[model samples]
Target: MIRCRQFYLGYPNSATVSHLLTWSHWIELLKIDDVLERSFYEQQTLLERWSVRELIQQKESALFLRLAASKDKAGVLQLATQGQQIEQPADLLRKPYIFEFLKIPEPYQIAETQLETLLCDHLQPFLLELGKGFTFVGRQYRITLNNRHYKVDLVFYHRILRCFVLIDLKINEVQHQDIGQVNMYFGYFAQEENIEGDNPPIGIILSRNKDELLIEYATYQMNSQLFVQKYQLYLPNQEDLRRELELTLREGTENASQSAKTLLDENDDT
Candidate 1:
């Protein structure tokens, strides 16, 4: 009884969403200690309509850490307050997307085709993992150009972005050629596949490994919207991810202070 009162005291907004959340949901949320993280999960649960089990899964996967690790301090605060507003193409990205629902054991030696098949078989969970606004178009979607045929591993339409998202899966590390290939698909999609009212297509390369230096060199000054991210067959190490998020936050804080100092110096000079 005392704990319940303390929980309510900590979370004043709980009264507003009382109609939506059950005791089970509150129980799952109570496990969280960070106020910002608790608010994030609470808001996302309402937005995504996640069940108790799904909420548990997300918390275990360290969804907050995964999303916050890539953002600046303001972005992290927005996540806590607004719960993932997808206004830009970059907002759709999540680093090292998790696919533990596939139930595939690690040391992933499976073929790319097999991986695609597994994701398709577990389509519902995959879509949820992919984040919001993704509606699957087709698997092994074919693209024809000049009497030649190319198969895209997976295709999804983003309702919010109003664009087609093409995915290419790689069991091994991503290469320069892979980026060029996805970029070509993006061009083809922009010209041939997209109809009126459609935004330019974006491409994603999902691989077991990603060489950041290779991607940086390969995608330098590229015009198209293309992203390369790694996929984990198993759940991530939450402690490691938390440490990474903490480091990113500390760096962002330092950078923000440095920028403020620079601005003050400029003002003084003027």
Candidate 2:
């Protein structure tokens, strides 16, 4: 019986066993690779809430390049490792959202009221663009202080941020006064409307043109929750914007160094 068993388990049988084992190992590795790939895509989808089409669009748009341009090496690695997780649905919304849903033309020649109306019309998309946790409170919200009636262009509550966001739109260039005015609006909200758990209100002054230099100077002395940003009827070159942001950050570092030097010189003279 032993001799018969040895003959059955001959060289050909051993080779077949070895081949089967090799194929099984390959299949196992392939399964692991598939799981990792699926996890990556799933993560990205959650983070960006990217539709398959949108994901394709992002790839074509060089979204990774844009992200690399904007973020540091660590940030890029972190984003890559973590993948995309949409903590907020609003993060998925595009900024300066094209009102294509309204069948509006390329250059939307409309007044501020018209823009507000369009936003109201496409409320869902607008909220998405506004970012996570935005609930529209009102439009042209009126507030009277010191016998003067001032109207805020738009008011929103951000649940995640736990703050009120006051949006003021400007068709022209943003001015120093605009910053001050928004600062005041933030003050009013903080003093009057903000709930106990809410963070300080945020004021966004959006204009067709913005002077970064002026904004820097204006915000230097103020602690108010105000942010100034330029808005375009059509999306400007994202690369140009990224370049500008890099230059601005660089200039800030240079300015800080110069100020420190001046302070040291003054102290020495004293």
lDDT for residue 31 in candidate 2, whole number 0-100? 31
For residues 116-204, what per-residue lDDT tens digits would candidate 2 score against the true structure? Answer: 67778878656644544578999889888999999899999877777788888876678888788788888889899987898888777
TM-score to native of every candidate shown: 0.91, 0.60
Can you write out model 1's per-residue Cα lDDT over 1-270, one digit (the tens) per residue?
A: 755986778767865665698888988888888877988998888888999988888887788888997887788888998888888888888777998998877565789999899999999888888888999999888989889999999999999999999999998999899999899899999998899999999898998888899999999999548999888888889889778777877888999999999999999999
Q: Which ranges in model 2 have alpha carbons more than 4 Å from their true place?
A: 1-44, 47-70, 83-108, 235-270
Instruction: Summing lDDT over every window of 10 consecutive residues in candidate 1, give the lowest-scoring window.
Output: 10-19
Candidate 1 clashes between residue pairs 3 or more apart in a chain or in different chains: none
Q: Lowest summed lDDT over 10 consecutive residues: which window, candidate 2?
A: 24-33
C-alpha local distance difference test of each model: 0.87, 0.59
Off by over 4 Å in 1: 12-18, 255-270
Q: All predictions: root-mean-square deviation over Cα?
A: 2.2, 14.2
